[model samples]
Target chain A: MGHIVEKVQEYLERIERSSINAYIHVDRERVLKEAENLEKNEKLKKRPLYGKVIAVKSNINVKGYLVSCASKTLENYISPYDATVIKRIKSQGGLIIGMTNMDEFACGSSGETSYYGPTKNPRAEDRIPGGSSSGSAAAVSAHLCDMALGSDTGGSIRNPASHCGVVGFKPSYGVVSRQGLCDLAMSFDQIGPLTGSARDALLLTNIIKGRDFSDSTTVDTPEFKVWDEEEMKNFKIGVIKEFMEVSDERIRERVERAIEVFRDLNWEVVELSYRYIDLALPTYYLINYVEFFSATRRYDGRRYGYPIEEVCGEEVLRRIMIGRHISKKEYSGKYYKRALQARRMMKREMLKLFKDVDAIVSPTVPKLPHKIGEKLTPMEMYAYDVLTVPANLCGMCAGVVRCGEINGIPVGLQIMGKPFEDEKVLNIMIGFEENF
Target chain B: MVDREKVEREAEEIVKRFSQILEKYTFEEAEEYYILEIKNVLREDEEPSVDPSFREEVLKIAPKTRDGYIVVEKSRWE
Candidate 1:
């Protein structure tokens, strides 16, 4: 226990010196007191995640901490209670280290949209850490925390994980309770884990997942099954053509090499295509606009820190305005309803494809993360999520693992499975990670 | 005293943006799509007990409070 406290202190020291801007808030005295309390408890060794330091994305509540969602709208707002996931982690002996930075209201693909500052990619300091779970991925990559919780509403977890060269898992929708998470898109969001390895991600996911009375969307999921070191032979992996075609040539090559690694292990690699895959990004963003607008109506300056429209960052404002416009009774059917139809079509297509293949694989992003302040249009930033949004659109479980590095920058290989097949996705990720 | 022309311009702009979004997904017009995944998970309608001090705790964080009530701007009608 003494050594664990010392290690945590050391990590805190490193965080103080770090320039990545990964954390929006850290309460040193409170963290040390919690660690000291754990040390005094003799039964600490019996608990899972004992002495593990877990960073939380700012959108997820940790009692008494700022759950700002990296926005000025909630800058001074303190969480009155812990999110269900935070409670689960703490109960399992995990220490809540700090709140990590993210895109304001989880609206951007790049980390630059954070009100705190952009979370620089630890792998490449100049490049943006892909977001909206930017700091969680960056902190794990820099070894500032053992694990972190991040919410994925259309690739928030996996995108940053891809850029930072760590493992991130977005469990099937409703697999993990979203009780205290600040919603991005309620229908698309799921709280997930990002860690240095798939095994750690799985361990954390198991602790946090299950039904919660506070979140009615949560379903009764089976107890998480640990994966045996099974051989990769005979597993059918589908290579999504749409993902490859949109990806940069270097990224595509790296992903192809990763697929070849699976092929070399005697697994069947099948090249497959979903015809309407290009429609995923537009559908995903449309849904995000509507849901985010609804979620933000609560921050009208009376209850929260400030009025959202008055203080939110540019990207956040853009989504809110668009969301309000689209949700108008006269225009709802034209944009919002049409997007929902496309979403259903995507889910149907994915379910049909899963019947033929055990899992789908692709490069996590279409292009490498650009320089931290690189000038990119909103549309260009949206394009970065082209390859990662389909999983969320279809309500499937997906995991991203570092596949290869191009010019010292990491590329992530995404593996996705049908709903409630989270364990299978993690297992496949574990197999690929070990082989790589 | 309705500004008919101004209202018409705003309406046209909204429709233009909506059309652009629809075109992005290759949808000429909105189509009815059933949400197949939703289930009505209704729980028993019973009021659960809450801690007496919960109100005090919540009020402590409100931006403006007076006499145990959250204060808000008065309505224009009022």
Candidate 2:
């Protein structure tokens, strides 16, 4: 009967009518009750996220909710406790709307690999909504929620955010606690926001970030600052030559057009070449395969859901198998160790490059989203992460904001900032969003 | 069912792709790099009290469970 409840009801109705398959679970009664309580709870209204509804990526635990990770491996698994991020959100009065669909165990790039089925792009109905944070991005794009939480292990957040025409951010590693996330890779995974605007992303980031005792990887970084209009100008944007060349022509044009906004503001746009960038995918996937294999060994079916190898989708199985092979003692140095060295080199390269430029700019994804259910080879799917993986590899902050559309489907311009300079990446995004 | 042979073939191709990169680049021996300096934070020795309801929740999700205990297969060691 209250306005808050009425508004939430409208969203729930839209979700019910939506064919996007963005959410895997929505406890309608619980959500409405929370909204109703928000109307009466005066103290809660004073909190930062009082009226905001959040959709969580299935990999992150929400107490008493099914945390399926979009895989049959834990299809019926209920979370016994809230993840640290969820605790923070609740403490700030953020209402969790539902669990969103994703690439099974956050393994796929195209969102179609979920056991529940792919999340349809709300912006481009027939095409894939990029993943493994598929539903979080789609939910925001479709107006199903004010914002969503997504786990980014090599662009899971920004990839889908770009495809769905929303803002998705991957905070610098160790900036946000990864405590309750069913991690894809411990070394790479970060939980971040998918929202309609850069400011909203910042608001969510501020709430979720900081040190937590439960997650030893967490760091108490300096608070992020909101940039003034004048502060956004006179910065250099480094356009990686490889990122541009690897993109489709139309996407390249859109990205070029997006860069002109910075140029118009008198920001110098420089071309920076990193030849080894071509190896980004293989290096990322090689590390990913090994870590994912190690992480999934816990789901042996006796304690949780089905054994992962028995019920997981093809992509998950592929990563597991490759991870197993590379982790073998005989092959360790040849593959996984080599990839680790490459990662270190890439990290050093990023540090050197950032010395000259404030942020690196590129198209968020190399190509536009392919049609849903279109069969892409494993290599082809992995190639989608080429531009975004470097940030994770080097532990840099990155964000995607829609700059323009290619044939009515949105194209995102990715801005990556130095590690812990998340505010700078966000401010640049905010600057572009304001000027665009 | 997972096709082991197909996965192996795919794995070989992927490994070959990266192997070429590794072969092309040479690096001096360097220590492993982690994002942060991690240390084992020790706490005061104490027994962790288990909550009964929380224990029940854990048992509930187990595919196989006995009275208040998760039932896992016995090891094959002699």
Candidate 3:
């Protein structure tokens, strides 16, 4: 274990400017010394993830470390305590390496608008690492960390996981505690694992997920059994035609090929549709605007920093303004209440779709990551998250697996299951990524 | 054709809601950014269906307007 930590330290130092702009801070000595401590603990008490090095998203509080959220607002700020997920991972003997960079304040989809600058795609340097969980995905992909913890609010984890060619899981909303996460949105935000493999993600999630006094939203959840590679080949999966038809041909083709692999393993494929999926974006944006406005009050610049508006990115300002507008008396619940109703419709559609299948399958992203400094109008960027938002609005657990490459860039296949059926999604993802 | 009533209402809503944010930015910078956004919204060429009261309410949010163009507090000083 000490040897591996030494290697990770060496790699962290060697990767100049980072192949992917992943880490916010790399305490090389701290991580290595912790590794040495674990190596010397002769009586290991069966911690689920013994000595595994984990990179955490900056939003989740880690004691004695800065919680920057890739924003200038909290750059010098240090967390006084650990988040529920962090405490659990620590209890399980996981070594915390450092904080990963993200889209500023967990805003934006392309990962370009972070205060720490953008994280590049490790697979293709010019391309973006999709975010706001950009650094966490890049860290695992670059072998900087074994696994990472990231927050997913409207596909923050899964989007980057798809773009960076890794496994990203967003647990059943409210099932995973959010006590320590510097939230993007109270209802939609969740902390989950980004890893090289589904197995690691599942192991990490199980360690952190459960009832916590800090977050009443989390239930006393049990770990679900994920099927082994051979067992999932026999599973039934549904492909949302809405997802396949919307993506670029190369991306859709890669997902199609992945589905074929599943079929060759004897899995059944059913074409499914719930047409109202178009409503997810406006609904997602509205819910996000209102909640994000509410979540950001602490950043009045006095607590975290003052006058953050000067250093805060445009996307952050946009949300703060939009959220502020939504809270006014006139628009009260017009956009928000309607969106919730739309969410209910989405949930109904998801429920009906999941009735005949064990898991729903599609490319986690419909397009490959675009190059950095390449300008995309904000709406075009928002369009990138179309595939994953429906899963979030309906409160389903979904996993992203690096399925194939498009023009040499990676595309992810998303496996989504009914609410709280994260284990089922994880099982299918393990089977899906065996080829990788 | 661009519906003046619809544009007027959207303009008002922008000023009413964001006047505070505008306080941080120059009134012209905010109004330029805000008014242009309101005008740029691709409105359908249909008869106004929004409430007349809402239309009046929206127009009231704007600080000034004349000669078919929404006016703003000048930024030449700041």
The C-alpha lDDT values of all candidates are 0.85, 0.90, 0.76
Top-scoring candidate (DockQ): 2
Chain A TM-scores, one per candidate?
Answer: 0.98, 0.98, 0.95
Clashing pairs in 2: none
Residue ranges of candidate 2 with Cα displaced over 4 Å? B1-4, B29-33, B42-52, B76-78
TM-score on B-chain, cand. 3: 0.27
Candidate 1: tens digits of C-alpha lDDT, residues B1-78: 224444345444544554565576554433323222556777778999665665776677789999999898764551
In terms of lDDT, which candidate is stronger, 2 or 3? Answer: 2
- A373-393: candidate 1 lDDT, tens digit per residue: 988766678889887788888
Q: What is chain B's TM-score across the candidates, in the order shown? A: 0.44, 0.69, 0.27
Candidate 1 backbone collisions, by pair: none
TM-score for chain A as predicted in candidate 2: 0.98
lDDT of 2 by residue, A333-419 (tens): 888888888888888887898898999999999999999978787889888999999999988999999988977798999999998
TM-score of each: 0.93, 0.96, 0.82
Query: Of 1 and 3, which scores higher on TM-score?
Result: 1
**What are the C-alpha RMSDs, in order, of all predicted structures?**
4.0, 1.9, 14.7
Q: How accurate is candidate 2 locally (lDDT)?
A: 0.90
lDDT of 3 by residue, A1-436 (tens): 4665675676667544465768888776777777778767665447777778889988888876778888887777776668888878877878888998889888988778878788888888889989889999988898878899998988999999988888999998767889988888776788899999988888998988887755656666777667656655567888888888988998888888888877877878899986866676776777777788888876655433444556677777767777777778787545555555566656766789888999988888777788898977555777888888887777788889988887778888888888888887887777766753
Q: How close is candidate 2 to the true structure, as a TM-score?
A: 0.96
